[model samples]
Target: MTVIAQLSDIHVRPHGVLYQDAVDSNAMFSAAVDSLNSNRPEPDLVVISGDLTDEGTVDEYQKLRELLARLRQPFVVMPGNHDNRGNLRAAFPDHPWLPGEGSLSFARDVGQLRLVALDTSVPGLHHGELDAASLAWLDDELTVHRDQTVVIFMHHPPFMTGIPYLDIYGLRNADALAMVLARHKNVDRILAGHVHRSMQTRLGNVPVLTCPSTTTQIALRVEADAQPASFLEPPAYMLHRWTGRGQPAVSHLCYVGRFEGPLPFA
Candidate 1:
């Protein structure tokens, strides 16, 4: 089995800075890094879905670089609405898996699993949309890696989360994404972030799982016209265990914290 760990919306800031001038997101993110490092069975790869920096500034990326140095597993990152693609690329010059220009998207193979990352972030926009170039890249990658089990990861989810306020910021061209996804049957799952909450839904038969942030979470207020809000809910991440080809990948939502556990099951 191939194990993939995912952390999203870290929202790291420069030293001595807090997210929204309140929550100490950097500290919280550090805790999450610790949690992943000590995770049992040890994940084979780590994918940070997006929102790596709160302001996408050089200092914030530098801080992120310092924080990521503590992680023991290999990692890759994508961009969200809050991220600056150019800055992110500059932050990690050694990550050749990432392209040097245009839409930070790429595909990699982890054992037999084909991991595809899609760039859905639009510059200077809060909502996301998959452009023709990105969609075409995904289609071609999926076409080339037809025999392997595939999982597509992106910043925005293709399905609505039922929260009106957050839904407004959801992927703008989900129908177009569905069209590309519908053609590929080898795609076992689709992973995404940007909602800052854990959600599950399907887009054209393929299951999509959104990872919770490493810091705060979005309040689950589904009432009509509910305003946008955040909560100090427990930070969390996801672990996807891909068993093999033609089988469903099992996912686990792991909360970051120290708690009583490993007790007798009597």
Candidate 2:
């Protein structure tokens, strides 16, 4: 069995940079880190689906790198819409998702899983696109690895969830992505971050998993007919497991920090 943990939307500090969330990202991220390190049956690999930093600053990335360096397992990090490609590249020089870079993919023949990181961030913007070039590259890569089981990791999701405010910021060139996905049958699951919600759905016959954030939730419910978002809930993270012929895969969703109460369950 191959174990993969998926952590999304880590809004690491150097706060006040994003000006929106105002949440202390480093603290929130640490809660997740502590939980993962102390959990039973540690994961084999970790995948962070972007939003590593709030304002995408070098200092923020520096702090994030230092924190992630504490993990007991190997991990791959990607960039989300709020991430700055240049800062991320320099912070993690060997990182694969750098702009204009060839590709950042890891192949584990032993586990029969090929982990692919797709760069979906649009520079100087808060949306995602699979651009013609990226789509072409993905198509070619899938064709070559037709026999290999694939799990794609990206920052943005291709489908809309009717969350209204969040839905407006979903992927743009989704049709292009959908067309490419249809041609490949080896893809097991398409995972993403950005939305900061634990949203699950199917796209092109494959499951799309969006891991929640470590800072705060965008409030799945509308406060009023007009209000859009709220931070009234605790932060959270996810773990994804893959079970093969010999190994089994399991994914877990964990909430960080303490909440109100147990509510006296029956």
Candidate 3:
């Protein structure tokens, strides 16, 4: 089975923007969809990495759900710091992803491959955590699917990306997470969001992929004094291709190309 499409930090508009990056969240999401729809090999699944709503309000979640409903295929989701679990459940009451108690933990089968979604959203907090329950569930899920290639999704980056701002908000219980992963050999990749920028690293031998936000992005600043986040770039998504065979899973950083001042797709 081939897995494709990942977008994050849609940060819906008319909402709050306490921090930096003010790129009309709605426009960013629109551009992200345009990029996805125009792609040649359309994705089988869209895994939105998190930050579905900016203010974590019921209205914002409703709006966010409506926008996501416009997508062409089936999609799974988790939450970032910006998302409120109550609001998320209220928006998509009928969704199978509902009732996320700090760990939505979705286990669905798409062909032979298994997709698992883990919740890292902590109420009223910026940093993320898995807790013991989520980690235990993950362990159990992988225990059953040891032979199949499983892909895990969460909102917080488990590995460091060098950006101080994002690094501080990285997964808090990463060691607990790593211990779980160390026991499971079936996990193919760990897909994450929340950095608002693209980053990649390895946890042991497992590949960890961080997709850029569908809204604005933060510049890669390894400098001591970095400017607050900027909104100079367009939105984007990620595409993961996995055909259960000799072929390995592949991921793409898809540019949604949506921004305040736009241009044509080349």
Candidate 4:
């Protein structure tokens, strides 16, 4: 089985403060990284969905690179509203698939899965949208890799999570994205971040999952007028296990900190 560990919304700040002193995102991300590296069955790869930095600043991206350098497994990143494409490309020059300008998107093959990173960030805007260019590129890529199971990773979810405050900042062109996704029968799952909460839903037969942030989690308030608030819930990440062909992919939500376990179920 190919184990792909996913961490999202790390939100590391250059000065080490995030969301108005709610949590130290850098430290939390470090802890999460350690946990993943030390996992009993080490993951084959790692994917950070988005929001690697609280602010899309040079200093912030530098710090994020430093933190990610400690990771043992190979990793890839996408862009969120909180990220700057230019800064990311500058920091990771080796990622040739990342365009120097425009949306940062790429595809990589991980075992039996074709991992596609889609950039949904809109410059100077909090809301996200997959533009025509990006959708077209994705369609072509899916067409070329029709035989491989595709798992899409993006910062913003294509579906609303019922939290009115956050929903306003969700993917603005979800219908367009759904249309592109519908034609791709090989798309196995869509993994996203930005909600800072773990969520599960579907967009046209494809499973979409949002991972919780490594620092804080958005409070689950479904009221129409609900406001945005975050809590110091245990930071977590998601592990996706793909067992080659003829088997379904499985995802597990894992908490970062330590807990007593494996002490004999009998």
Tell me which residue pairs clash in candidate 2.
1-247, 1-248, 241-249, 241-250, 242-249, 243-248, 243-249
Please give the range of 10 consecutive residues that has the lowest summed lDDT in model 3.
13-22
Count of backbone collisions in candidate 3 = 2
Each candidate: what lDDT?
0.92, 0.77, 0.77, 0.89
Worst 10 residues of 2 by lDDT: 101-110
Identify the leading candidate in terms of lDDT. 1
Top model by TM-score, which number?
1
Model 3, CA-based lDDT: 0.77
Off by over 4 Å in 1: none
Ranking by TM-score: 1, 4, 3, 2
- Expressed as tens digits, the lDDT of each residue in 138-214 for candidate 4 is 99999999988889999999998899999999999989989998887999899999999999999999999999999
The 10-residue segment of model 4 with minimum total lDDT is 15-24
56-157 per-residue lDDT for model 2 (tens digits): 888888888888878887777788877787777788876544445533333333267877788887888887887777888888878898987788888889
Order the candidates by lDDT, highest first. Answer: 1, 4, 3, 2
Pairwise TM-score winner, candidates 1 and 4: 1
